[model samples]
Target: MTNSPDILSNTFPDTPQRRLLLDFVADEADALQRGEQGGFWPDNHHLISPLIGKAGKFLDEDEHVAFFHHLLRLDHCPPVKTEEDFALLLRAYDGLGDLMSRGYPVCSLPFHLAVFLFGGDALARLPAEPEPTLASFQSGVSFLRYARSFAHMPGIMSKRQKFIDLSADRALVARVRKTLLHGHQQLLDGLGRLWLWAFVFLVLQVEEEAQPVIRKIREDAAAAGDVKRVETLERFIAAAGLAR
Candidate 1:
């Protein structure tokens, strides 16, 4: 993954916060290396569990962005392989999300893209049997939404577009459509509308099978008093000529 020089330079200006984040990244990298040498995998939750709150206490916006970028880069050298490795990646993604929720401008697009890619790979590698748990499916959908938010960014948009196109494959689309249609009511209440909107926007081709789902999402948004989201969904539906 190429780093944006402008983002790097702006994020790493000579500041106390910059030094602190850099030091933290260096320490985590060293720890990971040592753990690998000893044939021991570090628990991601144990590693970053405390820093969830501390990151907010110490890092400002630019520092937060720099910290996440450096930590994410660690996975590049030795790509995540095992379930434990993926858990570590998810922990890092969660840490970044925590910072962003606290008003820190942690450019989380890359991390979201990483999560989407890794999550899909993990799913594909799973043994065929009972379906993936709702929690797992929800997690994948959540990352996709985050990546979608940055679809206008350079390079990132193309990757997201690729994922969107792949997701439109007939078998996968049919499976996801069935899952969404028959999913638990509580799960639908929590993430269904957003997932529905994303699926409709990204994968579906405004065909007859897609119209009812689109209408349901629009109704859900309106009922929730999200006029802006409702309007956006309406525009997408109309633009796709899915609306009657």
Candidate 2:
């Protein structure tokens, strides 16, 4: 845990973190199931709690790692050299559209899935020589867009799939349940809490960048009093963490 800059610092969907985010995603299905079972699931307010909680946990771990190890040193890594490069890295990942329909676990991470499963072409098209900043901003934007998209999945999925089918093969209910029961001990080998911490580090950073854009989108929606947009933003924020 000492300051080792060699750690891969890149950006979103830091595979490990993405895995943790996906794990939390299981809760949405669980909450829907509980609600159906007549449990006292609150309204949207109940939804945000899980997201913030999961995100907070992830962030807490990331902070610890950073405190002990320092930022990842990816000097040779071209994708995260600058903000633009970051954006492009994420934009390049737009390829996940195909995978999302298949319900791959990566789909749970949305943008990361897009970047991981779909970014080949964009990446290939890079300035042949590629600049560190070329895609960073775009990638950041993609992260924001994808983060926003998370909010819709639970509501949409809840409506689309039956609760039983959603949680059929699952065990955990809310994120709290999963954390309390397994902690990181249960995560699959090579990918567990560490991965999630990376994700948290990346997103918390991205959220800082995304806030202005997200706020702009919200303000635009508010100016027009767009109820749908507000709801969508709320859902996106909530779902981004798989908390709600």
Candidate 1 — which pairs collide?
A: none
**Which candidate wins on lDDT?**
1
Cα TM-score of candidate 2: 0.21
Off by over 4 Å in 2: 1-152, 155-205, 241-244
Query: lDDT tens string, model 1, 1-244?
Result: 1222232444335455444444555554444334321111143435443453344345544444444444554332113334433444454454443332222123313322332333322223222323433344445555455534653323332344554565555544444444334322321343423434454454345264465555565666666776776665566555554544
| TM-score for each of the candidates | 0.35, 0.21
Judge candidate 2 against the unseen true structure and give its global Cα lDDT, from 0 to 1. Answer: 0.31
After superposition, the stretches of candidate 1 with alpha carbons farther than 4 Å from their true spots are 1-22, 25-168, 171-199, 206-213
The global C-alpha lDDT for each of the candidates, from Candidate 1 onward, is 0.42, 0.31
Can you give the lDDT of residue 128 in candidate 1? 36
Tens digits of per-residue lDDT, candidate 2, 121-220, equal: 2223222223323343344344333323433344433332232232332221121122212212221211222222222223222343335434554565
What is the clash tally of candidate 2? 33
